[model samples]
Target: MDTRHFTFALRHHMVADTLLLEFHGELDAWADLELAPRVAALLRRRRRAVLVDLRSVTFLDAGGLRLLLRISERSPRRKGRVRLVLDSPQILRVLRITGVDGVFTVLGELPVPFAADDTPDDTDVPA
Candidate 1:
């Protein structure tokens, strides 16, 4: 049997009091592990809000969905808000099917200020 491990990329941005995290590639078990600590640290800062951009995500599984929910729950404790941005129909279906679509604040695009970038192809990703 062949085993395959998937990886994802995360780009962090701050728009005033809002912390934006843009995710690309597959968000699975491995991604959940990699993202937990980074996200936890951000949550601890108690930002006014956090926006997770899933527009570029190619795949999302149950673990990924759970991670989003977990973030949402944790943010409010720190007096912060969490929102998700999704553009793919297939990804939307996953949320809808899981009955979590209504549970989150979902958007189509990155809200202003955060959308103004000098380089269209540039990704301000972390190492």
Candidate 2:
């Protein structure tokens, strides 16, 4: 399980070629700032699949939602894609209320055999 702890609120590990992020605390403005640099770097990498697990999150706010939406913006048609793994009622309710649940490819569990390609191409990833 190769992983890097981004902060108290976010921790990420790699499975196969997919990067999985697990949230432990509030992913508000603070976590958004802390995670931006890393996410920017990943976006620069072409075809890097990202998976976010939010089942552990107790709270969901706009700032956090923005971050998730940003990550999900990666083109799903290519190998560079983002999927959300969440089952929290609180989080689901927030997504539903915000009408964002339909915006993402939500999954109940992590996928097996992830898709990862290290070759990255610049894509105007905002930092």
Candidate 3:
């Protein structure tokens, strides 16, 4: 196997009260260094909600999975919700195999904005 370091990129924005974070490139150990602090900063701001867009993430490992879990755990205490948007089959499989899929509100795409009382249309990952 090629022992090359992986890199990751992040693009984020606010839609209504939700903070949408888009991840690109491999999400591995190396990428954690770049991602953790940024995410921490965002969390510190106490955003009402967060949506992690993983459509462009090409690779994920245990570290990456842990990071996602950490985000999910923290979001609720901050009075926010965290949803994940995943499009890659490989990434999806990893989550399923690890049984982490059930721990998150995974979606195929970003849900349409809805009032607190209204149910938004969302694609849920299969169990």
Candidate 4:
């Protein structure tokens, strides 16, 4: 319900069929609820792949992490893949400590280079 201090920008690379969702500002408890539905709707669009560019995100709590996990789960069932572009040590530590790091493929940084025929490797993604 509250949309203050939060913004989301989406940019797609048609060549690689990757949807880069850049999240800026805060992703706290309140924003988590509102943000998830939007993300879910976008995922349902059959974008082929989703790359969440969280590098610009200033903060992400447990709720935000949950949202990512949920979306990751849905992407595969819908015949797509999800990758999280995150470089923050805080987020990395949290994901690692909680054992969710293996749940999602965490890219080292943003602007991930992809070839036109890039395809998800079965070994690297979740079932």
Best by TM-score: 1
Candidate 4, residues 1-127, lDDT tens digits: the string is 3433335333333335665566665565655676676667666777777777677667777877787787787673443357788889987887888888887778886553643333433111001
Which residue segments of model 2 deviate by more than 4 Å?
1-8, 74-76, 79-81, 112-127
Report the CA-based lDDT of candidate 3 relative to the real structure.
0.72
Model 4 alpha-carbon drift over 4 Å, by segment? 1-15, 77-81, 111-127
| Tens digits of lDDT, candidate 3, 1-127 | 3223336676666667776777778888766765777777676677788888898899999878877887787664454347789888999999999998887778987676522323322321111
lDDT of 3 at 106: 85
Q: Please write out the lDDT profile of model 1 over residues 1-127, one tens digit for every residue.
A: 2223335777776777777778888877777777777777777887778888899899999878877887787674443347788899999999999998887778998777878842332243334
Better of 1 and 2 by TM-score: 1
Error of 4 at 72 (Å): 0.4
Poorest 10 consecutive residues of model 2 by lDDT?
A: 118-127
lDDT (CA) per prediction = 0.75, 0.65, 0.72, 0.63
Two-way TM-score contest, 3 vs 4, winner: 3
Which order, best to worst by lDDT? 1, 3, 2, 4
lDDT, candidate 1, equals 0.75
The clash tally of candidate 3 reads 0
Residue 124, model 2, lDDT: 19
Q: Estimate, for each residue in 21-51, the C-alpha lDDT of model 2 and write its tens digit.
A: 6666676776677676676566565545777
Candidate 1 similarity to native, TM-score: 0.82
- RMSD of every prediction: 4.5, 7.3, 8.8, 8.2
